[model samples]
Target: MHIGIVGAGLIGVATARELSRRGHRVILVDPEPLSGATHAAAGMLAPVAEVTYDQDDLYPLMATSARMYPDFLAGIEADAAYRTTETLVIAADAADREFLATLAEFQRRMDMECEVITTRAARALEPNLGTAIAGAVRIPGDHQVDPRRLGSALLAQVLQSGGEVRRTRVKAIEEENGPILRLAEGEDLRVDHVLVANGLNAAELVDLPIRAVHGDVIRMMMPAHRDHLITSTVRAMVQGRPVYLVPRADGSLVLGATSREDDLTGVSAEGVFQLLRDAHRILPSVWECEITELTARARPASGDDVPIIDRVADHISVAAGFSRHGILLAPIGAQLAADVVLGEGGNGPLAQSVRLGRFNHSPLEHSTRK
Candidate 1:
């Protein structure tokens, strides 16, 4: 089968790679591939640490994708992107500590590995931690990854596997004889199946209850003397807001992510300041790092915050609304989408759990979601 995937973000690229590996001819369509959320993501693959109070349904997908990371990266020969270092989620104040403690209790109740540790114990694990922390929890199963590296590796493998990447936007998808991808440039190409793995832009092609949730991320280089400043990922709750620091393999740190549903598309000043301020509370040595880059991207968020993966049309499948967890969920999202387009009859991909039909989706060719 020949498959056309729209929107070459991390999800689209991963889906293309999955389909290509499954012996399907694939054409990737996007104006800019990795420059979207894939480029800006901090790549913390922490399903345990990232859990929240009201997202029970999302845990299964996250855990499944976290488990799939090993084989997923290995298949692309990009195992170097996966980092096995564990995660430490700390609290700054008494209130923050109480919050994390309560959350940790909830986490443990769900059979997740969460150990409440004293600040001293946390510092022992990562000697460079600041003393200002009030409490901490060790999530040994949580880890990190390099999303940019994974994206580049996947894109390279797709190209090497005889998959075609059309460096243009897909104007529309019209079902003439089949799913015909009307390109913004060059001639239209028809494929047996079309998958819309685009981020929020998937809304332009297909109707979904998706909105843009923007986040700002900062990249920095640790000083020569302080290489590997913190060996593990650091997450903290300062006051009531959340912040995290993800260390890369090459002594760089990713301090990020302020979630906002505003119109500011570029990097946010307040967001960067909040991240740096909160990060300093966790690791005071953050000021010693050289600022490298600041990026902001909008994550496609569905109404339920869980991703929507389903066949909207007989020849079209849609996978979007990863929210901010796109980096953690891409592997499963890609596989589930592949399963949908391949006409697989099994229930392996949890398609029933996150399909558009959950919204009682009408036929795509007949109507669009309002």
Candidate 2:
């Protein structure tokens, strides 16, 4: 089977890699691969730490994906950027500690590993943690990866396996006889199935109610003397907001994330200040690092904040709106998406959770097609 996939972000590339390796031809289309959220993501595989309130369906998917990471990375030979570093979620004050304690309780009840440790224990583990920190929680299962390197590796492997990647935009997918992909500059390519996984942009091609939520990420290089200054990813809740510092194996730290649903498109100065300011409350040594990169990108989210996976048309399956869990859910999401595109039977709980019928989505209204 020849598959046409739109959007070359983590999800698209992962699905393309999965299908192509299984002897299916793949043509992935994107104007700028990884220019979306994947380009700016600090890949944190933290199913336990990222569990939010009332999102019951999400934790299962995340946990399943986290377990699948090892085998998946080994399959692609992209383990260089993968790390098993533990995560320490810190709290700045008494109120912050209480908030984390409540969250940890929920995590524990869900059969996930979350150990609440004192501030002293946290400082003993990292040694460089801020002295004034109130408390911390340890999650050994949480890990980190370099998104840029991992994405490049996935794309390279797909190419190595004889998949084709077209650096052009896909205008639309029309099904005259089968699925016809209308490309830029008046070109049309037909395919057996088309999968759309291009973040929020998937809305334009299909009736997915995906909206853009922007986040800013900053990269810094630790001082030469402080190599491996922090081995564990440190996430904290300062002033009721969340910020994280993810350390790479290369002695660099990624400080991020201010969630903004505003119309601002560029990197928010306030967001940067919040990350740096809030991060300092947990790891004061961040002041000594040199600022390297500051980036802002829009992550996709749906009305329910779950991924959309269903065949919206006869030969087109849509998989988008992963929100911040794009990298974390790639392993499982890619395989499910490939099955939907290939017409393979799948009625598992994970599949039912993300079906398009949950949203009551209106099917493709394009009358010119079919």
Q: lDDT tens string, model 1, 1-370?
A: 9999998888989999889888999999988888898889999998999899888778999999999989888856568889999999999999999999999999999999989999999999998888888999999999988999989999999999999888898777888778888888757888999998888888878878889989999999999896578989999999998999998888899998699999999999999999999999889999899999999999889877889888888788888899889989988888888998898747753667777766655547542332
What's model 1's lDDT at 311? Answer: 86
Question: Best lDDT goes to which candidate?
Answer: 2
- Candidate 2 displacement at residue 152 in angstroms: 0.7
For model 1, give the 10-residue run with minimal summed lDDT. 361-370
Candidate 1: regions farther than 4 A off: 360-370
After superposition, candidate 2 runs with Cα above 4 Å error: 75-77, 366-370
Q: Model 2 has how many clashing residue pairs?
A: 0
Candidate of highest TM-score: 2
lDDT of residue 134 for candidate 2: 88
